[model samples]
Target: MKNELNRNYSEVTEFILLGFRTSPEVQIPLFLLFLLIYMVIVAGNISMLVVIKTDSRLHTPMYFFLRNLSYLDLCYSTVIAPKTLATFLSRGKQISYNGCATQFFFFALFIGTEGFLLAVMAYDRFSAIRSPFLYTVCMSQKACVRLVIGSYICGCINSMIQTGFTFSLRFCGENRLDHFFCDVPALIKISCVDTFVNEIILFILSALIIITTTAVILVSYAYILSTVLKIPSTCGRNKTFSTCSSHITVVSLFYGTVFFMYAQPGAISSPEKSKIIAVFYTLIIPMLNPLIYSLRNREVKNAVKRILFRKKSFH
Candidate 1:
């Protein structure tokens, strides 16, 4: 009987995504605002990719990892945002059972990959600052590629586990997901059977990924700080610190919301808070990332300037 409950047959073919219980007055404006954010997210990320690809001077392990970050943000946002925009316009806001699972799968995969990449970027910064003499050998092009591949593999494994676990449960009762997107917690809320196992799995996985990656960032920065302190000149230390500042900003914005969304207990208590947190990470972060890097990263700013100047000169 216990085994049968885990595989409980789904009477619900489709789920009504009860996206934001907003008044009719606010719906269109909200939809338009989100639409604009999505446009910026798409354009800004593509611009970053283009700038990275064209500038030979910007070709390095740092920029390479950065390119992947842009791509990751672009993708995961696509998975969540468009559907969300559609949900706002849609009175039905209905998604198929399979569709919800697919959304969660891709979201988990890209997001997990991104978390690991940030850690890798932190370590790259560490290597450069700690061993300037051996930086090239330590972070060879081959090594960067290997690290990226490993991140994706880890992401895929994580996605498969969570997606399989969430969808395998028998969703025999309520089909209304209280959130805009198909998140694990929202899905678990509607499950007919006991979600103790699922809750344990969710807690364990989120903890492991969050803890391990955050540890890497903390350790890498500690070493980086130690090295930077040894630099004789204030200007040199400032320059080194400036390079890391953008990454810190991006990490704080992403991890803060994610930490709240998953690891925190308050998140489960209030569905509205969870949706707002989702908006920040899924919509706002993607849009802000390129702008953050461009404003803070001298190399990226210079690259943009060179591109614009060439275009101006051509005309």
Candidate 2:
């Protein structure tokens, strides 16, 4: 009987991900729409990464973080995009056990890194704006690289702990995940083993992430605002505001969707609601990030114009 039971358990290899609705009418349209979105997102992020790498003027600490952020956005989208694109076509969404775990691992890592990276960028801006004389000393190249590396390392460690806890849970029978992606909350709900420990750890991690990132961003912006107010020239004020506004907007969009999705009570968050928010985080934000930053920053525009002019001359 024990051997038979072990065989039955081992036979469960794949998991069915019940992604979105089953209506034929909706699936095709959604697939086309998400395909367009995925293309745009990939293109936008790649362009930003290329621009940062090629442009000498963008070698500052702020742009360094922006480059890292672009990379993170690319990675963050990759974790969810292909699977999401496939979902629009597959009659029933199916993700293998190992595949799901891999998704969760990278997803957690990049998203967590993004939070820390944004905070670091905000601090960079704050130092530049508030302590213009000390900006170089404060955000030196070595220091900036170290900070970004530290953020990535922290994210990796945090993700390992979370994924480790999640993987430790014994999944017995029900293999159907109600949502599109392999999210922690959705996966934990169906675990045959107790998830109390997971919940507590998740809560602690969530609180630490929110509190630490929020504190850093808030303090940075507070200093920035103070410096902005002191600027006597209207043009200077506007320029400063324009420079930071795009970053603020992207930050709000990314954090707002994440906080809303995770901080809310599970009882009130339906699968449909989760899908809507996930769309913002996974697709829309990645696509818009490059647009927002490039359009607002004068440096990027001039670089693009020069690049296009060079192309024209060559042709």
Candidate 3:
């Protein structure tokens, strides 16, 4: 019976993105605004990566994870921002089926990778704070590399499964997507067939990724807090808090929006609200990550100053 419906409904080859539709007067200003955002995202993430690589002082596990994060932000922003910018400038914002699937694949991949990477970073902080003498041994170079590689592997596996399931459904309804990008919820909503199984899989995957990572982060911070409070000196506690504050801020911002978007029951989900939340995680968060880290961390500021001073002397 379902097969009959699937066969009868015409398959969708392309999708129209109704991205933040607004008055004609607002379009150019919006375009310019996003253009500036994309530029800053590119320059900031890349510059942070360069600083981390060039400075030996940032060779620790925390900075290693941070470098991975900056790289992830760069890739994540590229996946959505360029296409979004194109949609703003052009009359038609159409994406082919394959192109849409490819976009979702990478988007999901990076998102999953980031979730686990944040957990790994939390563990790194736990080790540094709880076992300062053993921090080096606990988060060894080999261990760090393995953890990073494992995060990417998990992301790839999850993306392959979700993207395969999502695209396998027959999209027979209107080809227009309410959101800017090829998001899972938007795609699932447009499918002709019952998306019960797809939704189930999405829920399971999202719960496993988000809940597990959030749990790990909470646990790490719990122990970290205990350790920090045990320190007798107020100065030591302040320094310890400073080290983890930026990461905590970033995690809260990323997970808050993500959980709101993906973790909600379908009945209560509003497309408009989801799109607005999507903007935060996809665009705003990436732009803010470098700023948060650099501004909050004294070491990064010093490193940047040293790099600039060296260039000045060389010239």
Q: Write the per-residue lDDT of candidate 3 for residues 226-273, one digit (tens) a residue.
A: 999999999999999999999999999999988888877652247788
Task: lDDT for model 3, please.
Answer: 0.90
With a 3 Å backbone cut-off (N, CA, C), the pairs that clash in candidate 3 are: none
Lowest summed lDDT across 10 adjacent residues in model 2 is found at 1-10
Tens digits of per-residue lDDT for model 2 on 63-158?
899999989999989899899878778766888988988999999999899989989989899889877899999999999999999899989988
Per-model lDDT: 0.91, 0.84, 0.90
Clashing pairs in 2: none
Q: What is the C-alpha RMSD of each candidate to the true structure, in Å?
A: 2.3, 3.2, 1.8
Give TM per candidate: 0.96, 0.93, 0.96
- Model 1 / residue 214 / CA error / Å: 0.6
Evaluate model 2: give its lDDT: 0.84
Q: How many backbone clashes does candidate 1 have?
A: 0
Task: Quote the lDDT for 222 in model 2.
Answer: 90
Q: Tell me the lDDT of candidate 1.
A: 0.91
